[model samples]
Target chain A: MLEMSQVSYQVGEKWLLDSISLCIQPGEMLALLGQNGAGKSTLLKVLSGECRPASGAVTLSGQTLQTLSTNRLAKQRAVLPQKSRLNFPFKVLQVAMMGRSPYRGERYQASAEVVYDALKATGTAHLSERVFTTLSGGEQQRVHLARVLAQIWSPSEDNQARYLLLDEPTSALDLIHQHSVLEVARKFAREAHVGVLAILHDLNLAAYYADRVAILRNGKMLCQGEPFHVLTPATIYQAFGAIVKVMRHPERERSPLVVWTDQTESQSIKTGKRSVSQGINKSA
Target chain B: MLTSIQMHNSPGGTSCEAMREITATHRSENVDAASSVAHVVSSRRWSFGIGLFVLLVVVAVAALGVGAVSISPGEIISILVDSLGFPLAGPLDSAYQQIITSIRFPRVALAVLVGAGLAISGAAMQGLFRNPLADPALIGISSGAALAAVAVIVLGATLLSGYTAFWGIYALPVAAFLGGLVTTFLVYQFSNFNGRTSVSTMLLAGIAINALTIAVTGLLTYMANDEQLRTLTFWSMGSLGGASWDELRVAAPILLLSIVLIPLQASALNALLLGESEALHLGYNLERVKRGLIVLVALCVGVSVSFTGIIGFIGLITPHLLRLSIGPDHRFLLPFSALLGASLLLASDLLARTFVSPAELPIGIITSLVGGPFFLWLLLRQRRRGESW
Candidate 1:
């Protein structure tokens, strides 16, 4: 479990994360949803121990984050940043193998096996020999996902649950890959009992994959809970200033569908006729 | 929860033993494809390593044969064997023995040591900066040492006339080494802002610092008397003519210590290639690694410039040429560069010695003449490929 209590991060005079409190349990996927400049990445950094919070405490499993040594912290937590660019001509497998750097004591054969498994898990096995810089944006994103997966491929020595923090992992991915990547995370969480905290842009995707949803608006937590309880139309409007419909998915009943109502406005302008805008009126 | 065999649609791969074999084959094949030139270079790095060692020894021996008093290769071997407490099968002249053992050997050894030091330092700086163009001299290390050396040569007569006779031959190099270290520290400080050392900023700052140091060196040269001017010019051109057992005694320990310690950083450098944040994520202490690299490069390059003046381009070219032939795996790159660097310098020094018979050309002149064009070609090639490194 990763727990943050009244965690606030300030940059200069402005607060990026304002007294935010949250907990993520092992075997659970917690999706962090927010608009642009909503401190999603900053909060992810703080949780991953990349950035220090101004106040409050963060604990991974049972140990305080600040007290844990770097190598020990790395063995327990893996982070995939928003934008990672590699200019050198490293092979895809070599890039994946670097994820095992923290586990320097592990034998090379064992680590290589883990790297191969990670590549297979992310459906990037075919690109193992390809140069990393030659890959497409979506392919590179998946390769990095595989890298982080390989970072925490196995549990800790004491069998403590590990943490994986991903920032906008699917922003560059295609539709199939986006779903597959999230599915990989969900499966990893379920099987390995690892805690996952992902900052996502797609509301419906988050609802589908996440065990719980935490919504942030302007560095403040608007609401958080089971997707069904927190994703009502009124809450969506209050969080994102735009009106969106909260409906049940055709296949997954528990997951809510967040449909944008902006298309009707654009149609109204095109056709010189104003639609009733039922979703907006209902939210109001 | 499906195994790799099931995912890959292999019926026989259902067994763990078969899966392990498949993965091993997969990894080797990946390595082979990535280093497409692997076979043509050598079947194994060990063979390649042995080949380079043989090439260095041959070049070093060949260098011994081509000096002012030409000695046959057999005689050279005989002299080496006789010196090593073994009876020579062939008769070796006493004059030949004295020239080979005293004059050529120390010069050749110093050439090899300086070349290896500069090249390894360049490779390490390149990895640290993540830029192919990063050379220690390009970052004002050499020029800084040059400035200090020039200052000492011009001012030592009157300002330090008291201690000049006592320090004797040691003053110039000692001043140059201190100058190089101080300048490197200054450039490091200038580039680091708010605990982040920006490579682009460091490069630009290096350029400015180089310009400033060169201008100061020029001023010192202008202020020098006629004798001091000649000394400064000869020193700046860079030569192995000053190589003696005494100077080598001082420089060899520092160089050997640095060479032994640098290759240990291969894995850390490999991780750093991913980027600083990624290195940090991999549990590397970024500040410690960065600081350690700066100090190491400073020590290596400082000692080198102090001994041989400011030899340019060996550091930049050796690692890059080696990288293009071999892959960018620093484990092989660092050691191979050391061997290749030693060979290159010895060869260049031999040519510098014999190219104009008796009128010896400075080794720096030859290296710069070759390295400047090669550097330009590399830049154009990287531009054509649209790759930064």
Candidate 2:
């Protein structure tokens, strides 16, 4: 289990996460939802031990994350940062091997069964030797997922549940790869029994795959529950200011689908303006 | 789930993607497998193939015919063969043979060592810095050596008299070595903040230090007497005029030691071709590598400068030419650079000797005239595309 205890993070005097606390249980997938600047990614980084929190504690099992050494924390949790910039031509297998760094005796040790399994599971097994930087966005994400999956398991200790914290994992994926990738993450939770937390911009994907949805608005937890309970019309407007209709997915009823089935109020009617003002607004 | 995969699989969809992925994989794997084979084979063969050993024999023969005596090649060989206590068919003059053995031979050997040492140091420094513009002279190492030699000449510091003074030339090289070491140490210390040395920051530090040392050298030149001025100017222009057997003895060990250190470190330099972070992940301690190389290059530069003053391009040009010809594999690059460096320096020194009859020109003048424009061309070539990473 990974627990955040009254975690408060601020950037330049503005709180990004205000006195928040939550415990992520093993064998569960949590979706973090928020608007563009809602601190979802920062909170993920804070939990990943990439950024140290100013106050309070993040505990892995019973041990405080603050007390763990860098390598120790790396072994316990794997984070897929938003993107990687590698201008040099490193191959896909080589990058996937980098995920096994915390497990190795030295720099790059011999490959283990777990890394191989991670590569196969993500369907990136065939692309193993292809140059990583040359791949398209979707292909790169698959390779990255393979890397993180490899890191999220190690034989070092069995006392703690490994955490896979991804920042926008599905943003660049196409429809089919998106499903394939999420299925891989789901397998990690159900089959591998690891704790998974991801920041998602796509609400439909979240509602489809998440065990629970945690709504963050203006850097505070607005609500946290199952998708059906938290994803309502009022909540959508309150969080995003968009008028969206919440309905059951046609194929998967338990999952909620958001339909932006309504149009906007005229700007002149609302603001009492005589003429349209910005960016060729007369067409609208 | 397996049934769903089959159902959604368009006739040309999944298999097409998989096939393309496999082909790409095969191409990359082929490259990796090829490089790994090349690496293993190269290692198993000769580790460094110190080609300078071969060049020494050639230059030694060439140097015999070079002096004002104008002895034929056969005569030089006859004189050499005549000295191993063989009874001469005709008769060998004892004094002429002595001059050949004691004077010309050691001078030639010192020339070979000096060229190989400085050029190899430049190659190693370029590899270490991963910047093509690196040279023994570029990083203030030569200036430090220059400052020390100038100090000795201006101060009239002499340990021996007359012929002993001419032969006991090891003092200048020693002074130059000490100055180069200090400057290298200062550059390393000043450029660093945390444990790691930033390459750009290090380059800037080298440039500043280089400029400062040049300014100080100019001031020293201003204060010198006419005789002192001529003496320091000759040293700065660089030469092999003072190379005695004693001087060769001192420079030999330092050059040999540098050749050993850099080529032995070819794998480390290859690892550095990747950026610092990747190198660190590959398990090479970047700080240790950087410190090790800086010290190594400094040692080589110090020793070379001691003997030859400021012989310019051998270090910078050798590695680059080797790279153009043999590619940038440091294993090949290191040894090839040393060989090509030794050969080129000998040729330049030969030209320096032959340029104005009995009045010898400094070898450094020849290298700078050739090396400077070539260096500018490389710098411009590197800057043609995007900014350097």
Q: Which candidate is the best by lDDT?
A: 1
Misplaced by over 4 Å in model 2 are: A1-284, B1-101, B108-112, B148-205, B263-265, B379-389
Query: TM-score (chain B) for model 1?
Result: 0.86
Residue pairs with colliding backbones in model 1 are: none
DockQ score of the complex predicted as candidate 2: 0.09
Off by over 4 Å in 1: A263-284, B1-43, B87-91, B157-174, B192-197
Instruction: Give candidate 2's whole-model lDDT.
Output: 0.71
Q: Least accurate stretch of 10 residues (summed lDDT) in model 1 chain B?
A: B12-21
Chain A TM-scores of each predicted structure, in the order given, are 0.92, 0.89
- CAPRI-style docking class of model 1 based on DockQ: acceptable
lDDT digits (tens) for residues B124-161 of candidate 2? 77766666666778777888878876766665444323
DockQ of 1: 0.26
Please name the candidate that would achieve the greatest DockQ relative to the true structure. 1
Q: Model 2 - which docking category?
A: incorrect
Candidate 2 Cα deviation (angstroms), residue A49 = 9.4
The candidate 2 chain A region of ten consecutive residues with least summed lDDT is A275-284
| Top TM-score prediction, candidate number | 1
